[model samples]
Target: MEINLKNIFIAFLKISTILLGGGYVIIPIAQSELVEKRNWVTKEEILDYYSIAQCLGGIIAVNMAILIGCKLKGTKGALTSVLGMSLPPFLIIVLIANLIEKIVQIPNIDSFFWGVNLAVVILIYLAVKEVFLYALKDILSVFWFVLILVLACLKVNPVVLILSSLAFGLILARFKKEVKDE
Candidate 1:
C-alpha cells in the first residue's frame, strides 16, 4: 500500500501528542501504528531504524520518524513527519515552561513527575526488550549485549563502547562468513 505524506504527518502528530511518558512510551504505539495498523514498515525494519537512530546523535523518536517517513515517501514525508512530531511539543513546552516549573515546586506535582519518571523507566525497559527480541537472533548478538551491559555498568565511555561493539560485531560476522565459505 502506498503511504501518503499526510498520513505520515498525522501519525507523527498522534504519537507525539498522545504518548504520555516520552520517546520510550512511543515505541509500542509507533510499532502498532506503523507495523500493524498502517503496515508501512515491518517490525524488524522499525527495530533496525531504532538501532541506527541510537548509534547516531539525536532524539531517537524524531530520527526514527524521519527515517521511516523517508523510507515510505521520500523527502516530503520526512519533513512533514519531523514537523508534526516537533511542532506540538515545542509549542506546548514553550507555553507551559513557567507553569511547569511552578507546578513542579508543589509537592503533589513532584509526586506526579516521580510517577511519570517510573513509568518512563518501565516503558524503556519494555521497549528495549521488544527491540532485543526483534534484533538479537543469535548467540553472538547475546554475547555482544552482555559485553555492552558490563562495559556500561563499569562506566565506560559510551562512544568507545559503541564503536568497539560495532567493530567486534563486524569482526565476528566476517569470521563467520569466512568459515561458512570454507
Candidate 2:
C-alpha cells in the first residue's frame, strides 16, 4: 500500500482551514474530503474511525486525523496530518485566548455562534445518517441498531451498550453457523 505523507498533510490542511465548531462537525467534512474526494478511505472505514474516536475520548477531529493519517501513510503520515489539522487552530487559539472574554460580549456574536451551532448540528446529523445507512447491512445489524438506539435514548451506559452489541453479534454469528451446518 503506497501512501504519501505530503498528500495526507495537504488534504488535512485543506480540511482544517475550513473546519469550524465542535469536533463532531468535522465528520461530514472529513467524509467529503477523505472518502468522497480523495478516495483515500471508504465511507465504512471513516465511520469505523469515527466510532473508535468516540471511544478514545479526545477531540473527534484529532482522533480522526490520527486514524486517517495512519491509514494513509503510517506514523509519519499521522504526524503530518495531526500537525496540518492542529497548527492553524492552535495559533488562532493562542491569539484569541486572551481576547475571548471580550469577544464574547461583542454584538451579535452570540447569534452568529448560534447559527454556526445549528449548521454544525446539521452536519453531524448528515454524517450519522450516512453512517447508519452504511451500517444497516442486514437484519441482525438492523436489530442491533434499533436496540442500541432505544437503549441510548434510555440513557444506558455506553460501555455496557458496546459490550452488549459485541455479545449480540458474536452470538448471532455462532447461531448462523450452527444452523448452516445442520
Task: Estimate TM-scores for all models.
Answer: 0.81, 0.81
Segments of candidate 2 deviating more than 4 angstroms: 1-3, 166-182
> Considering every candidate listed, which one attains the maximal lDDT?
2
Clashes (backbone N, CA, C under 3 Å), per candidate, total 0, 0
User: For model 1, how does the per-residue alpha-carbon lDDT over 113-142 read when each residue is reduced to its tens digit?
Assistant: 779888878777766776776556667667
Q: Indicate the residue-level lDDT of 75 in model 1.
A: 92
How far out, in Å, is residue 30 in model 1?
A: 2.1
* Candidate 2 Cα lDDT to native: 0.82
Model 1: runs farther than 4 Å from truth? 18-22, 173-182
